[model samples]
Target: MNKNRVRLRCTYHGCELKQTGGIPYLAPYFDPLLQLLNIEVLDSSNHWKLFSKHALVHYGKQFARLGKLKRNDVIELTAQLRKDGSFVYPAHVRLLTNGPRREKIPESRTELIGYVMTQNGLYHLGGKYEYPHYVNQYENWLNKKDSTADQSKAESSSITPNQSYCHHHYGTHGNEKKGEK
Candidate 1:
């Protein structure tokens, strides 16, 4: 065990984790650990912030031990839910070539990686918004277009056509006689 390697214990009660490698399996409800460790919640909107920060430090030390992961080296992340709703043994560990990091980690060591742990009360290993269904839903919303009235209203509000132009083009109120001088 390297001096800098920080061992991550199970946040769940009564679970003794002797080995420390891979990502730290965190529970959806991590406030208890934060309270126990007195880790301040920097942003209430991002729940996983604190845990992610700790994971990087823990993993960094592990990386140093394994001789710094090459650019394309595989890094796997596995997490399981214990009986008490916290992460259990995180046993299904595997390795794959470089994975995606849509939201890149910042240079600052204190930054937290925000992610949703559970959806509708089930423990899912994939981080929040990783499913195709959710991605499709977001795509639908992105592709949706405003109604005609909404478009007209926005156009009218932004650019008021000159009265003279309107009269010359369509005439006022459609009441102009065809031959009126």
Candidate 2:
């Protein structure tokens, strides 16, 4: 057996049976593009995934050091086996990025990008998570402003007194009655 090949033990309660036929595991990392945890895999069909506890500790430390993983940071996967003859891969991992930036926006939003590790290979997490981009937010703000302006115009027009109706029906043009009739 190749020393690098992951070793596994039978997961029966009170029954300690080491097995060599277990599946490989690949840990996942944060993917900014997908805005979720993604795993890179050498082969997805191999049933490779992450070890939960290891992933948590690894990402916890990473988050502390880097603040948050944005997208495209390289993440490595570790393996683990369960007692029910099943497996649980890492569902989450830390965000590793180039560096942190203090955004100019008043809300203090930032962006980070990193890579995700999978059983197949390392994959790049895209720029979907970069904060302070503001394109979407700006569009929404503009739309609201336009809507409010339209509403104000409509309200002003509707609130005007019925001067035209009074003049045509009752000839009530305040001191100009003789000429108007």
Candidate 3:
């Protein structure tokens, strides 16, 4: 019954959440709980931005499926991220975790090219591209798709080098070649 930890079917943040209604209580506890896990805060400068870097990294983005990313979930997900990571916005966290049975949360293709939420407040994560590699990857993927499609077309077109041969590959008729009937 810690006033700090938001619980399932419990009221916190002045929001009355009922059980059957399936409201996510763990949503709000994510940040405060994450802080308790790590030893010290890394960089106080634009905390949320730094956290976004961690959260959107390989693991964080995966767990951003609502309820699935609970306080404990965030604790494990970040295992490294900290300093009041979840203190940003419970709704935003829900956008990431969304959990099971809740509306399935969609992964974003939008580059992390904007401000991100954190414990202290909003912070810029990918000033232009945080790491900038994702954009390259997406571009590479598009290229590969285009190349594969071109190759497929080339292969299909080459099926018959001689158009006449392809169209007149006559089958046997009454044990004799075509026109012998």
Q: Pick the candidate with the highest lDDT.
A: 2
lDDT of 3: 0.31
User: In model 1, how large is the Cα lDDT of residue 18?
Assistant: 21
**lDDT of every predicted structure (CA atoms):** 0.29, 0.33, 0.31
Error of 1 at 136 (Å): 2.9
Candidate 3 residue spans exceeding 4 A from truth = 1-128, 161-181
Backbone clash pairs for candidate 1 read none
Could you tell me every candidate's TM-score relative to the true structure?
0.18, 0.19, 0.22
Q: How do the residues 118-148 of candidate 3 rate in per-residue lDDT, one tens digit apiece?
A: 2123222555433234344444544665888
Report the C-alpha lDDT of model 1 over 13-81, residue by residue, as the tens digit: 110112234334432211101111211122335343333312212322222222213333433323432
Predicted structure with the largest TM-score when compared to the true one = 3
Q: Report how far residue 109 has shifted in candidate 3, in Å.
A: 10
Order of candidates by TM-score, top first? 3, 2, 1
Residue runs of model 1 more than 4 Å from their true location after superposition: 1-127, 146-150, 158-181
